[model samples]
Target chain A: MPKRRKCLPCLSGLALLAGALLVAPVSAAPKRVMSLNLCTDQLAMTLAGPDQLVSVSFLAREPGLSMLHEEARSYPANHGLAEEVFLENPDLVVTGTYSLHNTTALLKRLGFHVEEFSFAQTLETIPGEVRRMGALIGQEKRAQAIADDFTRELETIAAGQCGKDPTMIAYDQNGIASGRGTLADSVMQAAGFANLAADMGVIGVAPFPLEQVIAAHPDVISIGAPQKAPTLGEFVTRHPAIGALPDTRIGAFVPEASLSCGIPSVIEAVRALAALRTEIAPCHGNAAQ
Target chain B: MKLCMSLILLVFVLFVVSLLVGPAELRVEDSIAGLFAGGSEAAAIIMREIRLPRALLGLAIGMSLGLSGAVLQGFLRNPLAEPGVIGVSSMAALGAVLVFYSGLAGSSLYALPAGALIGALLAILVLLAIAARQGSTLTLILAGVALSSLAGALTALVLNLSPNPFASYEIIFWLLGSLKDRSMEHVALALPLMAAGWFLIALSARAIDALSLGEEAASSLGISMSLTRFLIVAGVALCVGAATAVTGTIGFIGLVIPHLIRPLTNRMPSSLLLPAGLGGAALLLAADIAARIVLPAGELNVGVLTALIGAPFFLWLVVRARREML
Candidate 1:
C-alpha cells in the first residue's frame, strides 16, 4: 500500500509538471491571486483582472476596517491560514508585514510566489504601493493613472491650506490617539492640521489622557465611527470632556476605514479634513498669495 | 470610636488625593474652581466628568467590597470568605461579559449590572447551600477556587467569541479590573444599587454578631436563621454584582481590607463593618492612584495592585490557619 501511495504521487507530479509546461506559455501574468492581508486584499481587488483574485482575507469584508468592503462581498475570503492558501493553490499571494509572519514563512517554504507590503505606510508611500501592487498583478497602466490622480488631488488640497494650521487628533476607542509615524498623522499634516498627539511626543497609537486632551484643546477631535458591537473603550471617545472642549469640532470626520490604511481612497480623509480646515479657518490669504 | 473616625478621615483624604492626581497636572486652585465655580469649560469637564467619576467609583466599589468581606467573614465564621476569594466577583464578571459582549442587550451600559447580578446571585446561593450543609472552611475555599477558575475561563471564552476584534483585549480589563475611564454614568448606574445592598447588609449586622457565638446560641437570642441568610445572600449579590459589573473582578480588596481593619476594632463583627468599609475605600483609591503613577500613559490595572498586596497577606493567613489546625 505504501509503494502504491508513492507511485500515485509520482504519477500526479509528472502530470502537474506537464500541465504547467503547457500553460506557462499561454500567459505572462498569474491567473489566480490570493491576498492574505486586509490592506493587500483591497489592493488586489482594485488591480487584479476579473477572476484573477481568487480569495481575500476575511477582514476585507469587515465594514469598519475595509474601505472597499462592499466590493469585497464578490470575492471569497481566506482566514490567512497557510492551509487555506495552499488548498486554494493560487499562483501569487500578497500580504502585509503587520501580521501572519508564520503563515508567510510557511507559504514561502512551499515555493509559492509571495509579495509583502510594509505595514508602516504613509500618504507619501500610497502611490508607490499602489503602483507596486499594479505591477505585481500586471495592471501597471491603470495603477499609474490612479496613483497620478491621487497625487494631483493631494497637491490641490495642500495648495488650499492656509499658513494657519489648526491642530487635530485622530482619537479612537479607549482614548488612543494617532501620533507621529502613522498614516493618520500624515493625512492630518497634509490636510493642514498639526497633529497634536504627535507634537506632544507621542509615537504611534498610545493612550492620550482625557485630561491632556482637555488641556490642549485641539481644534478638531476626529473619532472613529462606532462599531456594531459595543466596547467600554468606545465610551472613552464619547467622553463628556471631549464634548465640552470649546470651538472643537468633535465627530467622525473621516469615513469609516478611510484612515485605517494608506489606500488611494485615503484621499477621502484628506479631502474631508481639508474642507473642514477651509470652513473653520479659511485660506483666502494663501489663495491670494 | 477612634478607629472609626480615623478610617473615615483616611478615606476622605484618599478620595481628595484620587481626585487631585491625574496626567493633566491641573493646579489645586484650578481644579477646585473647575469642580465648583465653573472656571474654564475644559477644566470643569475634566473635574466633573473625568476625575470625579473615577474617584467616586473607587470609593463606592471599595466600600462595597470591604463591607461585604467583613459581613461574609462574620456570617460564615470563615476568615477567608470574600466576594473575589469565594468566586462571586468572578461569576459576576463572567455574567457581565456574556451579556455585554454577546450583544444580547445591545450597546447599553445597563446590561452589565443586570447580567452580573444574576451571576452573583447564583454564586451566593450555591455558597449558601454549602454553608447550610455545614461545609468545612476548607471545603468552601476549595469550592471558591473551582468557581473562580471556571468563571475566569468562561469570561475569556466569551470575550474571544465576540465578533468585535477589540473584545479580546478586554479580557484582561474584565479579569484584572481598572478604574481608568469610568464616568458619572457608571457611578449613577451602580451607586444606588450598591447603597441598597449596603443597607440590607447593615440590617444583618446584629444577626451576624449573634451568629459568631455559634448558630444555636444566635437562634436562642431570637435571630431568625432564614432571615439572616436571605439578607446576606441578597445584599452580597447586589453589592458584589453591581461592583463587578462596572469594574470587573477587583481581587483581594474584599479579602484583605476586613482582616487589616479587624485588628483596629474590638473584635466584634458588627463593629468591624464600618471601619473595614472605610479602609477598603482608602486601599482601593490608593491602589488606583498608584496604577496611574506606575505607568502614566498606559495605566496599570487596579486589581494587579490589590493582588500584589493581598496575595502575600492571604498566604500569611493560610500559614497561620495551618499552624492553628496543627
Candidate 2:
C-alpha cells in the first residue's frame, strides 16, 4: 500500500511534466501555417491536425487537380504573393522550389521559417514527406502513422504486381507525354507497366509525335482527365489515330488528381492501376483470360 | 504576263523551300518521296501531316492575304486598307476566340471558320458603312485603327477569360500569326472558303478597276454601285476571315504587295490583282521559310516576320502618303 501510495505522486509529477510538455509545444505549434505550392498543400492538409493549417494555395480549391478540395474550402486561400504571406503572418510557410524562386528568396530574406519540398519527388520520397510535414506541424505521431500506412499500402500494391510489365504512356494535353524521370514513369513502373515514352529515349515531359505514339504501339495510354471547359489540345487525346489502335486501353485510369502529385492518395492510383495491370496482362494467364 | 509567271515561279520555289526546311532534316529525296510516293512512314507523316499542311496553308493563306489586300485596296481606294489594318482580321480573331474558347461549337475545327466568317462579315459591313458615307482617306484610316484596337482588345479579353492556359498563350499567335505545325485538317478548313473568296473578288475585278476612276464616273459607265460594293465586301471578308481563322492575322502582305506589284502592272486595280496576289504569296512563303530557319526549334511566328517587314513598310507608307497628299 505504501509502494502504491508513492506511485500517485510519481504519476502526478509525471502528469504535470507531461501536461507541461504537451501544452508548451502545443502553444508553439504555429498558429497560422500557409502552403504556397500544390504539393505542399497536399502534405500539409494530410499531416496537420484540425485548425492547425490556416491556409492553402488557391490551386488547392480547384477540384480538377486537388485531392482534398473539400477540406481545402474550410481554410482561407493565398495566391502565393509575398505580401499575402506577410499579411497572413504565418509562423511557418511551405512551398515547392519549382517556381517563385524570387518569392522564396524574399521570404528567406524576411526571416520567415520556410520549408521547401523538391519537385522531382518520386514514389519513394512520399512517405518521408508525410513524416517531415508531420514533424513541422508538431504532430509527429500522427504523421508517423500516416507515413507507415502510406508505405505499407504502397508495399501491398507493389506486392500485388505480377510483373507482366505491359507498356503504358502518360499522354497529356497538346500531344505531350511523360517520359523517364517523371512521376508518371515511376508510377507506371510501380504498377507493373513499362513507360513506352521512356523506352523511346524521351527524357522528362516532351512533345510526343502522334506518329511515334502510333509506332510504339503501347498496351495502355494514360491521359489526364479533361477539365469542364473545352480546349483544342484535348483533340489529340480523342484523335481518330489514337482511337484506331486495337487492344489498347486508353483512359484516365487512376482517377483524376491521384497521380497529379506524389501524395498519400496516390496509393489509390497505384492500387487502381495495379488492379488494371492484373486484368490486362496478368501473370496467371488463365485467370486473366 | 511574264512578270506574273515569274512571280508565280518565285512562289513555287518558296513553297518547295518551305517544305524542305523543318526541325526534322529529311533528305531531299525523302521529302519528295514523302510528299509524292509515301517513302518512309515517318518521313511521310512529317512531310504530309506536319510540313505539307503547313506548306499548303502557307501557299493558300498567303494567297488569301495577298488577294484580300489587293481587293481591299482597290475597293476602298485606300493604300492602307488591308484586313489587319481595318480590323477585319482582328474581329475574325475575336470571333474565333469567342466560339472556340466558349466551347459553343464544341471542339470542332469548323468552329473557327464559322465564328471567323461572321466576325469578318460584321467588320466589312461596319467599314463599308463608314467608307460609303464619308470615304475620306484619313477618316477610313482612323476608323480602321479604332476597329483594330477594339477587336484586338476583345480578343485578348476572351483568351484571358479562357480556362485553358494554352488558349491564353495563343494570344501571341492570334495577334502575330504563325504557320508552324499546321495540319491538313486546317488546310481543309480554310482553303475552300478562300477559293470562293478569290472567285468572288475576281467577279468584282472590272468593277473595282472602273470604280477607281472616281465613284461618279465609274457608276455612269454602267457599273452597279451596290452590287460592286457587295462583291468586294463579301470577297474580302471571306478571304481575310478564312485566312485569319487558320493562320491568325498576318499583316502588310496586302499593303506592301499591291503597292510593290502595282508598279509592275498597268496601275489598273483589275491588272494589279493577280500580281499582288502572287507577290503576297512569294513574300509570305519567304518570310515563313525564314521563320522556320531562324529559330530551327522554336520557329518564329511568320506574323512576327511579316510585322518586322511590314511595320517599317507601313511607317514609310504613312510618310509617303502624307507627302503625296500634300
Candidate 3:
C-alpha cells in the first residue's frame, strides 16, 4: 500500500511533463504548410511565399484548371487525402467545403489547424475569401495585391466587350453547367458575353439537359476541360451538335491554376474569354458578312 | 401475415401522402378535386403531371424489382442473390449511360429505354450462358461478380472519356438512383415495358414453386426449367432494365422486400410473389417520401437512403443467418 502511494506522484509528474510537450508545439505557428484542396492550394501557393509551401494538391498541377500549373510544378503534390497531409507535418492545412468531412474532423482532433473554404458561389464573395485566407496564412499584403490585380483585369476585360451582345454557354464535362451565381457566370459576364446558363436559372452543379443547350443557341460555347487528356478542342469535335451550331464560335478557357479557385482565376478566365472572342472575330465577321 | 398486411397498408397510406405533397403544397380537398373533377390548374398539374406519374413509376419499379428478386432467390435457393449481385443493375446502368451520353436519346425519345433494354438483355444472356454451363449457384455468382465489375468499370470509363461534365455527374447520380424531376413522359415510356415484364414474372410463380421440389420433380410436374429460366431473364431484363433506364440503378428494394415478406407467406414462392410486389412498392414509396421530407432543401436519392439503411440490415441478416447455421 505504501509503494502504490509513492508511484501515484511519479505517474502524475510524467503526465504533466507529457502535457506540456504537446501544448508547446501548438502555440507556435506552422512553418511548412501543405494545401490539400485545389482551391486552397492555389491560394497557399499564391500568398504563402514559395518556400513556405511544402506541397499542394495534385490537381494544382493541371494546366487546364490551374493558372499556376507551371509555377505549381516546383512543389511536391499530395492527393488531398488526410494520410498524405500528415506525412509532411504541415503547420497549416487548407481544404474545401466539399472535401471529406470525416478526414477534416480527424485532422482537427489531432491538434492540426485546418482552414476550410466552403463553396463560394458568387464572384463578390471570392475576394473576401482570399483576404480571409491571407489573414490565416500571414500573407495579407500579397493577398490584397493579387485581389486588386484581379479586379483591375476584370474591369479591363469588361470594358473592352461592353457593346457586344454575345450569348455564351460553358459546356463542362457530363453536360453539367455553372448556372447563375457561379464563378463561371462571373467569368462569362466579365468577358462581355451573356451566359445562357444564367438565363435558365441554374444555381449549382447540376446536370443541364442537352435539349436546353440546343435551344439556347448561344453565340459562343466555352467548354471547360481537365488539366490532362482530351482537351476542349477534342470535346467539341466529339459532340457534333456543338460543333455544327449555326453562327456559333467555340473556344477553350484553360486557366491552368487559380483560374477556377476564386477571384484571381475569374480574372484569368475573363482574359481567356476576351482572347477567344478576338480569335473568333473572323467567324463572327463571316456570319455577319 | 397480419403485420405484413398492416405494413402494406401503411406503405399505401404513405404513397397517398407522397402523391398529395410536393415543392408546392396543395390542400387535401383541392388535390382530391383535381384528381376527380380536373379542377384547379396548379392542383391538376401537380396531380396529373407530377405526383401521379412519380408515384406510379415508383410503384411499378418497386413491384418489378420485388417480384424479380423473389423469383431469383427462389430459383437460386439463396437469399443472398440480388439483381445487382448478379450483374443486371450495372448492365442496365451501362445501357442507360450509353444512350444518355452517346446522344442517341437526344435523337429519339424511345432510344433511351430501347438501348437500356438491349444492354440489360445482353447482360442477362451472358448470365444465362454462364449459369447453364456451370450448373452451380457458386459459379453463377462468381460469373455475376465478374460481369458486374466489368460493366461498372466500363461505365466509369465511358463517363470519364465523355467531354460532357453533366454526363459524368448523371452517371454517378443515376447509378445511385432517384425519382426527382421525373416527368409523365418517363412514366409513359417505362410503364408498358414494366407491365409486360410483370406479366411474364407473374406467370412463372407457379413454375418457380414447382422447381422448389427438385429439378426432376418439377420436370415431372410438366414445367420446363429452360423455358422458365428464359422467361424470368427476359421478364427481369425488360422491367428492371426499363425502370433503370428511366430512373437509374435503384438497389435493395427487390432484394429486401422479398426477404421481409417471405415468412408471412409461409415460405411459398408463389404465395410470396404478389405480397412481395406490394411490399416493395410500399418500401420504395416510403423511402422516397423520407428522402423528400428529411432534407427539404436538398433532394436525396431514394436509392442512396435505401442502401444506407439496407446495407447495415443486410449485414446483420448475414450474421444472424450464419449464427443459426452454426
Candidate 4:
C-alpha cells in the first residue's frame, strides 16, 4: 500500500515534466531572427513581434518589391553576405531557395540554423506559409488565428466570383508577361480572371508580341507600377497601342509589388483585382456594386 | 545628284520594309489602311506607334552617321576617320550613359540627347586640338583610339553603378545599338538636332573642297581656316551625338557607307556628302529590316549587323592602306 502511494507521486511528477516540455516553444523561441529573402521578410515582419526580428534583406527597403519597406527600416539589412550574416550572429536565418544558393549553403555549413522557402509561390501557399512562419517565430497560436482569418476572407472573396471569367494578362516590364506557374497567374485565377498568357502556352516570364497582345484584346491588361526611373523597356508598357484599346480596361489593377511573391500581403492584390473584375464584367446585374 | 536621288529611293523602300516587318506579321492591306485610313485601331496603333518611330529613327540616324562620316574623313584627311574610329560616337555614348544611367536627368528621354551633345562637343574639341597640334594622320588616329577605349570603359562603369538592377543589362544598348521599339518621342528628341547638324555641315562644303588641295593651299585660296574647322567640328558633333543618343554607338554606318559610295560620287569630300547621307539612310534601314527578319523573335542588334559588314570592310581598308604605304 505504501509502495502504491509512492508510485502515484512519481507517475504524477513524470506527467508534469512532459507537460512542461510541451510548452517549451513559448519559452524557447529565438530572440533574434534574420530574414535573408524579401518574401520571408514580409512573413517574419508580420509574425515576429517587436524587437524579435533582428534584420531583413537589403531588398526589403526597395519600395517596388517590398510591402513592408517602411517597417523594414527599423531593422538592420543584410546583403546575403556570409560574413555579414555570421557577424549578426542571429539565432535563426531565413531566405529563398531560388537565389543566394551559395550564401545559404555556406551558412548551413557553418552550423547556423537556416530555413529556406521556395520561390514557386501561389495563392494556396500563403495561409500555410503564414502558419509555418508563425511556428518558426514562436507565435504559433497567433499565426493559426491569422491564418484562419485569411482563409475565411479568401473563401468569402472566392465565393463572390461569378461564372463570368474575364481574361487578363499581366504585362510587366519589357513586354514580358507572367504565364502559367507564376504567382501572377495564380492570383489571376483566384480573382475570377483567366490568364491569357498562360493560355497561350507561356510557362513563365516570356516576351509577348505587341501585335499578339493587341489582337487577343483581353478585357483587362494588368501591368506593373512604373518605376520612377525611366528605361527604354518601360516604353513597351506606355505604348500608345495599349492605351488606344477602347474596350479594354488597363491599369495597375494589382497593388504595387503585391503579386511579386505569394504571401498574405498578396491578399490585398487579390481583393482589389476581384473587386475590379466584378465592376468591369459583372456576373449579373445583381453582382454589380 | 542622280546617285543621291537613287539612294533616297532605296532608303524609302527600306523604311517601308522596316515598318512592314516585325513579329506581328501584319498584312499589306491592313498596314496601309492602318497607316493612313485608321480603319483598324490595332493596325493603326502598330503602324503609327510602334513601326513609325523605328522607321523615322532609322532614316534620321542613318543620315547623321553618313554625313558625319563624310565630314570627319574630309576634315581629318584620313581615310580611317569615321566617327567610331575617331571616338566621337563612343564618346557621345559615354555622355548619354553618364546622364541617362546616372539618373541625373531623372530618367527622362530628353537627357539622352542633351548629355550626348555635350559629350560629342567635348570629344570633337579634343580631337580637333590634337589634329591642330599634329596634322599627321597616325597621331590623330592613335589619339582617337585611346579616347574611344577610355570612354567605353567609363560607360560600362556608370551603367554598373546605376541604382536600377536592369540598368546593367542595358550596357548592350550602349555598346551595340538596337532600335527595336523606338517611340515618336525618340524621333522628336533627335531629329531637330540632326537637322541642325546637316545645315552646319552643308555650310562648310566649299571650304572642305578647297582644303583637299592641302591646308596651306586651301587657306591661300581665301578660305578662313578657323571658320571651316569650326563648322565641320560643330556639325559632326551635333549629328553624331544626336544619332548615338537614340540608337547607341552604331558603328561602321559612318565608316563603310561613305567609303563605298564615295567612289561612285565625284570623289570630292564636298560632293560625297549628300550621296553618303542617302547611302547611310539606305544601309541602316536595310540593316534594321534584316535585324528583325534574321532572328524574327530574338531581334539581332542593328549595331551587330552594321559591325559585321563594317568590320571586314574596315580590315580591307587597313590592308589596302598598309600596301599603299609600303
Candidate 5:
C-alpha cells in the first residue's frame, strides 16, 4: 500500500509535464520564424523580435523589390526552397498564397505551422496583415503600434485630399500600368489622385497602350526607376511621347521599393503622393473646398 | 516601270495608313493638324513621337529586309535566299541581345546596331563560304537552319542568364519583333545604317545580275567577284542588322517581298531590288497596321503576322524547289 502511494505522485508529475508540453505551444511565441515570400519577409522583418526571424526570402535583400532591404541583410536569406526549410526547421514559416505553392503544401504536409499572406494586398488590408504577423511572432504590441500609425497616417492623408484630384498612372516596364484593384491604385486614391489607367478601364497590371497613355494626358505619370540591370522594356517608360507631356509631371514620385508590396511602410508612398498633390493643386480656395 | 510606279504608290499609301492607324483614335483632321500644326500637344506628341517613328521603322525596316533578300538571292543564285530564312536576322538578334543585355555598351541603343552588325557580318561570311564550297541551294539552306537553331537557343540562354528578370521577357521580342512603343530615338538609331546598307547593295547591282549567269561566266565578264562579294556581304549585314537591332528578328519580309515583286519585274535581279524594297515597305506597313488593329491593347508582334504569310509561302517554295531538283 505504501509503494502504490509513492507511485501515484510520480504518475501525476508525469501527467503535469505532458500537459505543460501541450500548453506551451499555445502560449509561447515562435522563437525561430522563416519567411519564404517577399511580402511576408517584410512583415516579419518589421514585426519580428531580435533573433526571432531566422531567415527571409532572398528577394528581401533586393533593394529594387524590398522596402526594408537594408534591415533584411541582418537576417539570413532563404531562396524559398523546401530543402532549406527542412534543414533550418524554423518554428514557424510564413509565405505567400500566390507563390511557392508546392513548398507551402509540402511544409503543411510535413506538420509545420505555416501562415500564408495573400498577394492581392490593398491599403485597407495593411493594418490587418501587420497585426496578424505581429501576433504570430509575439510582437503584438510593436505590430499594433505600426498598424495604428499606418492607419492614422493613411487616414490623415486621405482626409487632406480635396479639390482637384490630379490624374496619375503608375506606368511600369513594357507599358504596363497599375490599374484598379492594385495596391498602387489604392495608394493613388488615398493621395487624392485619379488612377488614369483604372479610369480607362484597365484591371490589375495590364498593358496600357502608349498611345492611350499619351492621349489621356495625365497630370502625373509615375514611372518605376530603371532596374539595376538595363532592359529594353524600360525604354517604353522613357518613350519620348511620355517625355513630351509638358504639363504632366513625370518621375519616380514614389520611393524605390515602396509601392511593390502592401506593407505598413507603403504609407511612405501615400505620404509622398499626398505631398505632390499639395504642390500640384492645393486645397486652399479650391472649388471642392 | 509600271511595277515600280505602282509599288511606289502602294508604299506611299501604306505609309500614310500606318501613321493613321493606332490604338489612339485620333480624328483624321486632328491627326494631320497635329502632325504638321501642333494643335493639341498630346495629339502632336502621338503623331510626331509615337506613330511617326513606328511607321517610319515599318517602312525602313521593310525596305532593308526586302533589298537584302533580293540582293542575296541574285548573288547566291538561289531563289530561297533571305535574311530571316537563312538565319541572318536570327544571328543579328542574338548579337543585339548579347550586347545590350550584357551591359557591354551601357544601355545605349547604339549597342544594338553595333552588336547586330557584327553578328550579321559573321553569318553572311559563314553562309558565303558554305555557298562557295557547295553550289547546292539545299546545302546552303540547311546550314542556315542549323545556324538559326543554334543562335536562337543561345539567345534564349543568354536572356535567361541575365541578372535582370525582365531580360527574359524580351526573348519573345528578340525572336518575334514588335514595333510597339518605338520612338524617334529608335528611328534615329537605325535609319542611317540601313540607308548606308541600301547604298552599298545598290553599288553591287550589276555584279549580282552578272553572277546570275554563273560564277565562272561572271568572272569572265570582268566583274570583280571579290569586290562584289564584299559589297553584298557588308550591304546585307548592315541592312538586316540595323533593321533587327530596332525591331528584333522580324522574319519573312525579306523572303516574301522579293518573291512577290520578282514576278512583276522582268526577272532581272537588279530590277527586282527597287520594286522589292518598295513592296516590302508596303507589306510591312500593312502588317504593322494590322498588328495594331487586331489586338489594340497588347498588339500582336509584327513578326507573327509576317511569319503567318511567309511560312506558307516558304513551304510552297520548298516544294517547287524539290520538284525542280527532281
Candidate 6:
C-alpha cells in the first residue's frame, strides 16, 4: 500500500510536467503583439500572420505621413505610450531605440519580453536587424528568406547598373543630401550613378554646396521623398537652378519600406532603384557628351 | 499720381520678368504663348500652374506685410515697430505649428490658415489689452517685445519636443519667411482680409500724421485718441495676421520698405502708405528672384536675405535717431 501510494504521487508529478510541456509552445508563440514605433508597426503587419497583432503605433495610421497607411488601418493602434502598451497585455512588444526610454525600462522591470531595433541610416546594418526580429517572433526562416531576398535584389541591381556614368546625387529636399555611408548613397550607386557627394570625401550628412551641384553637373538628380513632406515637389521646383539642370532627369524616388526603416525596405529600395536605372541611363548617356 | 503710375508700371515689369524667368528658362514669347495656346504641355504647366500663382501670391503677401508694417509703425509712432516685433508673426507661426503637429489639420488644407488667423487674433487682443492701460508708445513697445519673445520661446520649445526631425527645419524656414511655392489658395485666403485692413489703415493715416505732432495735439485736432488707437491696432492686426498666416513671418520688409520710401513721399504717413505698398511689392519680388537665382537648385529664404540687408540699414537709422535725440 505504501509503495502504491508513492507510485501514485510520482505519476501525478509526471502528468503535470507533460501538461506544462504541451501548453508551453502554444503560449510561447506570440498571439498578442504590440509595436511601439512606426517602423516596427509596419514590420509587424508585414511579418505577423493576420489577426495576430494587437496594436501598432498611432503614427502608422496617419495617411498623410505614413507609408503604410492602408495596411495600418486594420490594427488597433496605440501611441506607444507605456501605460497604453502595458494595458493591452501583449505577449511581445517591439520597439525602436527612439521609443520612450522610461516606458521601455518599466516594461523590462515588469518582466515583459521587450525587443528593441536600431534605426538604420546605412545599408550594412539591415540584415542584423532582420535576424534579431526573426528570432524574437519565431519566424527565423521567414526572416532569413526575406534577408536573402534583400541581398539578392541589391546584388542584382548593383551588377546590372553599378557602372553607369554621369554621377548622380541624392538631394534631400531642405538642402540636405546623402553623403557616403547613407542608404541614399547606396541607392544612388546601385542605380548606376556615382554619388558626386562621395567624391567630396565626406561621410554621413554633409553640406553639399549648390555650387558643387552645378559644378558636378550630375547626369541625374534624384530627390528623396520623405513621407511627411508632400509639398517637397513645390519646394524643389522653386529652385531656379534645379529647374535649369541641362539633360538631368529629376525624379523623386520612394525608398522601399524595408530599406526606408527596416531590413525588408532595403530590398524594396534596391528594386525601386533598379527600375529607375533605365530612366537614368538615357539621361546619363546624353549628358556624357 | 505720376509716381504711383510709374510704381505700378515697375511692378508690372517685375511681374512679367518673374513669370518669364524660372529654373526651366522659358522665353518671354514662349511664356505668353503658353499662357494663351497653353504652348507645349510642360511649358503651359510651368507658366500657368507654377510661376503665375507663385508671383501673384508673392505680390499680395508683400503688399500686405508692407502696408501693415507702415500702419503699425505710424500708429505706434515708432519706426522700430514691425509685425514680428509686435508678436503677430510669432503667434501666427505658433498657431500654424500647433495645427500641423496636433494632427487636427493633418487631413485638411484649410485648418492651418484658420488656426493661424485665430492665433493672430488672440495675440492682437493680448497686445491691445496691455497697451490700452498705458496708451504710451514706450508701454506698447515693451509689451510687444515681451509678447514676441514669449512667442518665439514657445515655438522653440514646441519644435524641440516634436518627434519629427523635419519640424525644426520647418520652423527655421518659417522664421526666415518666403513666398516660394505659394499658391492661389494663399492669395484667395489673404486678399480680402488685407484689403479691408488696408482701407482701415488708410483711414487712420491722417490720424497718424496728427499723432506725430503729439498724442494730445492729435486729440485736440478732433481725432479721438481712443478711436484712432482702436482702428490702427485692429487694422494692423488684420493685415499682418492674414499675411503671416500664409507667408510665415517676413521680417524687416515693413520697417525697411516704409523707411526707404518714406523719404520719397516727404515722410507723410498718409501719403507714404500707397507708395510704400508698391515699393514693398517691388522689393519683395526682387528679393524672391534673387533667392531663386543665388544657388543652382537651392533657394534662400527672402526673409533672411532681407534681414541681412536690412539690419545694417536699421542700425544706421538707430544711430541717427539716437544722435538727434542727444
Best by TM-score: 5
Task: Encode model 4's per-residue lDDT on B133-217: one tens digit a residue.
Answer: 5667777788889989999999988878877676777788888998876778888889999999999999999999998898899
Question: What residue runs in model 5 are displaced by over 4 Å at the alpha carbon?
Answer: A1-26, A285-289
TM-score of each predicted structure versus truth: 0.94, 0.84, 0.58, 0.91, 0.95, 0.64
Stretches of candidate 1 exceeding 4 Å from the true structure:
A1-27, A284-288
TM-score between model 5 and native? 0.95
Model 1 CA lDDT for position B314: 92
Docking band of candidate 2: incorrect
Q: What's model 4's overall lDDT? A: 0.86
Give the TM-score comparing model 3 with the true structure, all chains together.
0.58
Best by lDDT: 5
Candidate 5 — which pairs collide?
A: none
- Best candidate (score: DockQ): 5
lDDT-superior candidate, 2 or 5 = 5
Which lDDT value does model 4 have at B49? 81
TM-score of chain A of each: 0.89, 0.86, 0.77, 0.88, 0.89, 0.77
**Which is superior by lDDT, 2 or 3?**
2
Candidate 1 vs candidate 5, DockQ winner? 5
Instruction: Evaluate residue A232 in candidate 6 and report its C-alpha lDDT on the 0 to 100 scale.
Output: 21
Preferred candidate (lDDT higher): 5 or 6: 5
Worst 10 residues of 6 chain A by lDDT: A229-238
Q: For model 6, what fraction of the real interface contacts is kept?
A: 0.00
lDDT of 6 at B99: 73
Q: Candidates' DockQ values?
A: 0.57, 0.21, 0.04, 0.34, 0.69, 0.05
In model 4, what is the error at residue A82, expressed in angstroms?
0.8
Tell me the whole-model lDDT of each prediction, alpha carbons only. Answer: 0.90, 0.83, 0.73, 0.86, 0.91, 0.71
Write candidate 1's Cα lDDT for A1-289 as tens digits.
7999879989999999877744552346788999989999888887888999999988999999999999999999889999998899988889998889999999999998888999999999999999988877778788999999999999988877666789998998888998999999999999999999999999988889888998898999999887888888898898776876778999999888997788899999899998899898875753637
User: How do the residues A33-122 of candidate 4 rate in per-residue lDDT, one tens digit apiece?
Assistant: 989999999889988888999889899888888888898898888887899888989888888989899999999899887878888888
Candidates 1 and 6, the one with greater TM-score: 1
Ranking by DockQ: 5, 1, 4, 2, 6, 3
**Can you write out model 2's per-residue Cα lDDT over A218-266, one digit (the tens) per residue?**
8998887877667656766765556656688999897787766788888
Chain B, TM-score, each prediction? 0.98, 0.98, 0.91, 0.98, 0.98, 0.90
